[model samples]
Target: MDNAKLQQHAIAAECFVEVPFFDLDPMHIVWHGNYVKYFEQARCELLRKIQYDYPQMKASGYYWPIVDMRLKYIKPAKFGDKLLCVATFKEFENRLKIDYVIQSASSGEKLCKGYTVQVAVTTTDFEMQLVSPPILGQQLHQFIQAQ
Candidate 1:
């Protein structure tokens, strides 16, 4: 989705990260794989804001695992460059779908944009759930009501 469409979701979170030297590749820019880490950081912030992070998910007898992920890199993030990562809920009833954007902290230039899709799975039986569990609905409801 486009940026305007991404803004339509009320459930979202943002976090800032400074690219670490260790994440640099031989070319001296961030490795392609590191973007996923940045996305996860922002995603965790979103889940925490909704009070349904990993611990809560497990406690609710469900495990939400990423089944799909896609990323588009527009620019290279160098070491020490600060980036703003945003994560927003795209769809959450049937599965957890989140959209992400990574931009330069100072310039606001988008460095990368991506999305992740996760589906609920039963922790006890290890069965993939066709629909999200009730706890997710409850948490999402609470988030929307609070906003």
Candidate 2:
């Protein structure tokens, strides 16, 4: 499969969040670690939209937990600032990977970009998957084709 084809799997979701005071560090800006929570929120929403959220994965006899994640901070967000978080699916086959972009709603300035990779595991034996299950591939294929 081509990387370009993977881009075709892009699924996006957006959310607005206020920087709570508790998320701020001594620097008076939202702490970097909090972005992971924001990413999870958007990512979960995207997955649910496709009828394949984490619970569904487990019920389908597999567990998918993020095994890898990377984030790049382009700008800082301050307390009370509302930001837009966008999550997009970038890869789905042997692994499930999602890319995220966060931007200031008022200025449209990019605040951060990141990605998370998750691998499927058999719930019974806890074996890592080298190839995606047919259920996942079929769901993704149907979703992409319907779009």
Candidate 3:
């Protein structure tokens, strides 16, 4: 289904994390690279909910590798700042596209926004999959139907 249709059903996972002091730069702001870990935390939650996470993909004989990703920094987070990360499934047919939003957990200030696109490939021969594994479609259908 297209993004417009998928938005109507809306499968999203939200998670929380605090900016660790170790992730901070010399300026005491969260290092830019740390946002990707935050995004993975929420993305794992979203994937687990759909039962198509990494382990499941491996079991299904495929590896979904992240081929494209981009992030936009709206505001910088500081050490000890609490973050709320939201991951929403955007596309799952040709590739898995997940959109993310990171905001302050308390005041809800948007900090960053981005998306990742992962395409599946067979584990045995490492051939890229033109279409998603059947299990993904099945799970998505069930997820949407129940919603």
Worst 10 residues of 2 by lDDT: 1-10
Instruction: Pick the lDDT winner.
Output: 3
Candidate 2 wrongly placed segments (more than 4 Å): 1-4
Which residue window of length 10 is worst by lDDT in model 1?
1-10
Query: For residue 71, what is the lDDT in candidate 3?
Result: 99
Report the C-alpha lDDT of model 2 over 54-98, residue by residue, as the tens digit: 888999999988899999999999999999999987877778888
lDDT of 1 by residue, 53-124 (tens): 999999998999999999999999999999999998887767889999999999999999999999999999
**Stretches of candidate 3 above 4 Å error?**
1-4
Q: Of the candidates shown, which would achieve the greatest TM-score relative to the real structure?
A: 3
lDDT of 3 by residue, 1-147 (tens): 555777777799999998888999998899999999999999999988877789988999999999999999999999889999999998888888999999999999999999999998999999999988887878787777777
Candidate 1: stretches off by over 4 Å = 1-9
After TM-score superposition, the amount by which residue 67's alpha carbon in candidate 3 deviates from its true location, in angstroms, is: 0.4
